[model samples]
Target: MPEPTARVEPDEIRRWLSERAAYYLERPVEELDPGAPLAELGLDSVYALTLCGDVEDRYGLVLEPSAAWDHPTLDALTAHLLAALERG
Candidate 1:
């Protein structure tokens, strides 16, 4: 098996989320918050999947299909991602 990469910090996760949110929502990164729900921020299922793909590409992490529902907020998602990274 390939060695796992180091886990990203919360701030870095937040930054990554903000950038991805901006890209998917076509809005300014300054407006995104880690506590905001993706649905509340205009993310539908398709957009969420696309965002997941972007995250996987950026971080080399594969997200579960249910991640969008399970980790609804950016903060929750970041926490889950960090945990997954640690486990890997």
Candidate 2:
């Protein structure tokens, strides 16, 4: 397993998440809205799972599979991730 990166700010997480979601959606990051539901932007379950894996690998986090469903948006997800990191 890879070591976690340095502590990251919420905006950084949000930007990273937007880029990842954009990649999964096959769109530009600029097209993504932080407040918009990722599912509505076409991030299906498979992508969500992949995203969870990415988060785990990047942040060394053990997240529930339903994390994306629970957070639902880039902003919400970023906040959750930031909180998780801070708790560590």
Candidate 3:
């Protein structure tokens, strides 16, 4: 019998976050924890600000500067992005 495959999100927001976080933290995406706080991953002010810009550019939305803090986890950030994107 063949093994089952896992379902994936089409937007790939989670994948984007994982890759971005990994790049920022100097690690591989596979080593990142989706539910882990980005701050705990060594995300500093510069990283946070750049990430906010990245999100805004990617979604074409106006977001607050503190958005990274508001959505600390990859899951939380992705959920918020999905909701915002759906609204537009």
Q: Write the per-residue lDDT of candidate 3 for residues 17-83, one digit (tens) a residue.
A: 7888888889988888888898887888798888888876765756787888899888888888777
Worst 10 residues of 3 by lDDT: 1-10
List residue ranges in candidate 2 displaced over 4 A: 1-5
Candidate 3 overall lDDT versus native: 0.77
Q: Which candidate tops TM-score?
A: 2
The sequence of per-residue lDDT tens digits that candidate 2 reaches over residues 1-88 is: 3235467878888998999999989999999999999889999999999999999888888889999999999999999999998878
Q: In lDDT terms, how accurate is model 2?
A: 0.90
Using lDDT, give the best candidate's number: 2
RMSD of candidate 2 to the true fold? 2.0
In candidate 1, what are the lDDT values of residues 1-88, reduced to their tens digit? 2236654687787778778878888999888776889899887898788878877887778887678779998889888877877776
Models ranked on TM-score: 2, 1, 3
lDDT of the candidates, in the order given = 0.79, 0.90, 0.77
Question: Which of the two, 1 or 2, has more TM-score?
Answer: 2
C-alpha lDDT (0 to 100) for residue 2 of candidate 2: 29
